[model samples]
Target: MANSEPGLADFTKHLRKWFETRQLSSETDYSEKLWIDIHTLFQVLAKGIDSTNPFSEAVCEPDNPAWTLRSHAAEFKVCQRIVNIFLFMDGLHYVNNGDWQQRYIFNNEQRLEEYLRCMLGHVALLQLYGDNCDHIELVRTVSNSMDPFREAFRHADISKTCANMNYRNIQIGTKLIGLTMARWMEQLKGTRHVGSITSDKPVQICNQGQGTNTKEATADGVRQNGHMPIVEMMEDGTTDVVKKLIKKGKDMTDEVKKRLIETVKDSTNPEKTMEDILDTVSKCTAPGNACVQSALESVHTSVTPVPPNPADHDPSAISASA
Candidate 1:
């Protein structure tokens, strides 16, 4: 069955009516800092239905019990509704830059913080005692809704040193308890992490720390070994050369290829071997190929002579010779 619960709009209207009845104004500056009557609000929440109390009737059922031992689920829903009311108030205060007429609703920063912490404690208790998945889901939803209030309270002031200490303790205790309860639930459901087994291997428990250690070892080994073998280093180099040759081959125009072949055929040295032609082609195609350039220079020096140029002679001597 669909939940017939009151949504945010219903809660907002109810809260606004309550504020209006109490003559709370967002514009009022209560510098004297009168404490917001939180107990009165609780009493209003507890009150069931009456023609005189329209807000209560609109927000909750006619016979709704605020604190009930009969049904934990019912009580949890009540608490959730209450928390939502506070969340709405907090949002209003935030959006208006703390200028809401209901700003006086919280007597001071400390009061507001205490109120938020109290609600958080209530929600945590509900979560601890929750019986079913639906109850747990409601608890989670309420917790999420109240997160902003908790964050705001974190930065709020505490008037007394002891109050501040107690607040911090409460916050820590609630977190630890929530986590412990969740872990207990996981274990109860047998949903906690378990080791895995493969066909050939024994059961191996997955450990994040172990994985991290393995990664560290690999990184440290690489750092310690400054260089790899020449052959291993040249693996990527050879791959790059093949890729570059393929790309150049694809992009080489038919005209360009013909011109290269003609140049090779018209070589001055008739005895120039196929190897020499290939070396020259490599150098011409890839001027940045260091290996090809070195090889060609070595071959040229070994096979070819350095011819004397007449231009290298003194100009006057060349003229007289002529």
Candidate 2:
């Protein structure tokens, strides 16, 4: 069920029109790259959804099956599209300076959110349709696909607003995918024969020598090697944690600096400790912090709003008028 040429063309045309309506197409370089990425994402998703068949090899060997391979590849493609959308949105935000509604067509954020919700829903539905059929491999494939996107988003120098929105969406999508897999595994376990013994089940071991049991042998081996406890063994763990904290602090430094400068200009607080300063900075710089956003909103409302450009029509309104 791979997408045909006409279908692909129609999808691309629709996307192009959407971008054009939003005035995004006015920027030649941005629009060209955006359209290419969108087209690729649409093609990948269409092909993957069409070609996936989780039941093709239902009775094959437990370890590997024809369906597993096809489904895994398809799911990976779906995940790639998810990540592409995020990166594309980040790129758009990087070049544009405005609120979400100002930057894109009306309802664009809602549309993207709906699309992600539907994609996650489709994956859950696919697993449900399999009826307790094992798709652990597919689940693993989808989970692993998220790593690259996570790393990219983690390090991307994007606004807190954009980052928080996309990050929450990605997190939700992955959690849904994981829950679907968990449900599938639960169903599979429920259907298994009562007498079955899984490979993970502990086995009875006879003492071979020195009256040593398996548990005792394991302890003895650890003691002989002078292995520290798990937490203590992680010598670099504390250093890693501190480094992450410092990185987070550095990332917020600009906002913190702005707040500090503002405070100094206003001379609101004459005396404050380092702890108090940090606490104030943390409150001000935290993503989506209610206090900071509320203050900004008040300031924003005090200014006269500029009318939206007539050329930038709302896509939803345009559709309704048509």
**Each candidate's TM vs. the true structure?**
0.21, 0.20
Name the weakest run of 10 consecutive residues (lDDT summed) in model 1.
313-322
lDDT of 2: 0.30
Which digits, one per residue and each the tens of the lDDT, describe model 2 over residues 161-258? 11111111111111212222223323433442111212221212312355765445533543453211111111212222222223334444456434
lDDT of 2 at 297: 34
Question: Which candidate tops TM-score?
Answer: 1
Q: Model 2 TM-score?
A: 0.20
Q: Please give the distance, in angstroms, between residue 277's alpha carbon in candidate 2 and its true position after superposition.
A: 58
Off by over 4 Å in 2: 1-40, 46-132, 152-313, 317-322
